[model samples]
Target: MTAKQDAQLTGVPSAAMTSLLPGPLVDDAWLAEHLDDPRLVVLDATALLPSPRHDGDHRSASGRPGWAERHLPGSRHADLTSDFSDPGAPCHFAVPTPEALSAALARLGVGEGSEVVAYDTGGGIWAARLWWMLRAISVPAAVLDGGLAAWQAAGRPLASGDTHPEPAVTPAVPVLRPRLWSGIEAVAAISRGEHPGVLVCALPPGGYDGSAPTRYSRRGHIPGSRSLPGRGLLDDTGRLLPRAELAARVGAVLGTADSPVVLYCGGGISAAGTALALTVLGRRDVSVYDGSLEEWSGDPARPLETGG
Candidate 1:
């Protein structure tokens, strides 16, 4: 693997956010009040990845149509799975170069001083994916807790039709934050126990246990990873669990270990949702495995483990 293979994610240098969010995660109540802020850019980064056999997210379905049917009043579609991905990469949803990402952000009207709030309908994973991508390059961004469902449940108004905001005047190029991204090398080292830190698998139970279908060529998870499905971090309404409860969920696995944590899942999507949860819990050392199982499992020599 080359340098690019190690850390696929990149972003602009940390620019001041005109409208600072309370934290990395925000609720519908807060967003409702800030809808009119010119510096605030809300993106429905909802990319649906269903099964390969069906017209699911990974294959044909797109969140654009759903965004068309109904979305936040001033929100635009930030196509994380496509527009922001490196189409030439071997795996799915590959993070593009800094130049590519800066261009994409410009297209989304995210210029310097912009505050991004990403939300998704399929769950917070897609939104979290966007958040992780931006934060990796020092962009000021956050995920909408519970996503579109929470927005609707709060009786917030929605609008149909597309939003084509004019390009940002001068979008700054992002600098990659290497620590936030773990390439295949880091994951393998951690898996082999040569590297310090825990390997956390954020996929569902079936995926972790090798009992469910996978998008990758192999089944099961990386060796020595603990099961913490991304969806498990969210409550029934799609909002993240309360802070104290969230601490308990993560603490159960982390304990007093205070070590670096590398998170991964199929194609690095859902793992981000878990990363968001950890960030909410104040763990800045968290990094998502960029390639995740899609890359790891591709090489049979890498090794895998199954069962609870």
Candidate 2:
């Protein structure tokens, strides 16, 4: 059957009827209460990010085994490195086409009406990527506030092994929000002073300053971009910081909430974490550079800078 037919059969609404929840982040208590709701779809969007010293081959370094071993009850696995990304792209985890994304979500029983709650074992990094992808398609979704760590800390039940529900139907026509992404051209423009926005590098300080071991074509970072590691947005326990603290830290780099912001990391994974933090902090005009340094550093024409 055609995607539209499948969507109609499964009760997936069209674009006009799509509605998002009030907040992008949900606490463990909120998720526990809604866990058994028929309309709710929980996804363990866990991924093991590539090490700085390794090339951008995330498929070989994924956390799928952990998901198979244990995950939140009734949650399905969403593989960011493979299933949800563009396999043909030059860099790892390139955003997939709307059709590809819709198919992946459908396989996980996520429809237009499905209220998705995405979480990860690696805190919020991978989960936020799924959340951002859902937003791109106008699907209503949220991230589990502290992910698996928080849920386990609360003594929640866990289920092992894989679970496959019947596929869900969503709108055949997916909404692609261009503004939500910054392409290489956009980054180049920003680099050459042809575009206006604050470029935020979401890697670690070592990665930002060229002191970290790297496997990219070049070391260093995009010149003029501020270094605000995505991990800094979270506490030692992996929970996000309080709103006041988040506002102050991000505000210090962004200057104003009205300023356009572009977030990028090694291969666009950690960047999503910062994007999620910004969303919780009430920043509206934020976008992720999909290629990030993976694409930037690989190009010989692009310039890189070292040191703070």
Which of the numbered candidates is closest to the native, going by highest lDDT?
1
Runs of candidate 1 exceeding 4 Å displacement: 1-19, 51-60
Candidate 2 residue 250 C-alpha distance from true site, Å: 0.8
Model 2 C-alpha lDDT per residue in residues 179-203, reported as the tens digit of each score: 7889988887887778888889999
Q: What value does the lDDT take at residue 306 in candidate 2?
A: 90
lDDT of candidate 2 vs native?
Answer: 0.81
The digit string of per-residue lDDT tens for model 1 on 1-308 reads: 33332222222222342236667888899999888988888999888777644211246346898898999988999887678888899888988887788778878888777878999998899999989988877677888988889999988899998756576557667867878889998888888889998999999898899877777777888888998888877789888888888888888877888889999998888999998888777676889898998889888898988898
Pairs in clash, predicted candidate 1: 11-137, 11-174, 12-174, 12-175, 48-57, 49-57, 49-58, 50-57, 146-238
Model 2 lDDT at residue 156: 88
C-alpha root-mean-square deviation, candidate 2:
5.6
Error of 1 at 28 (Å): 0.9
Clashing pairs in 2: none
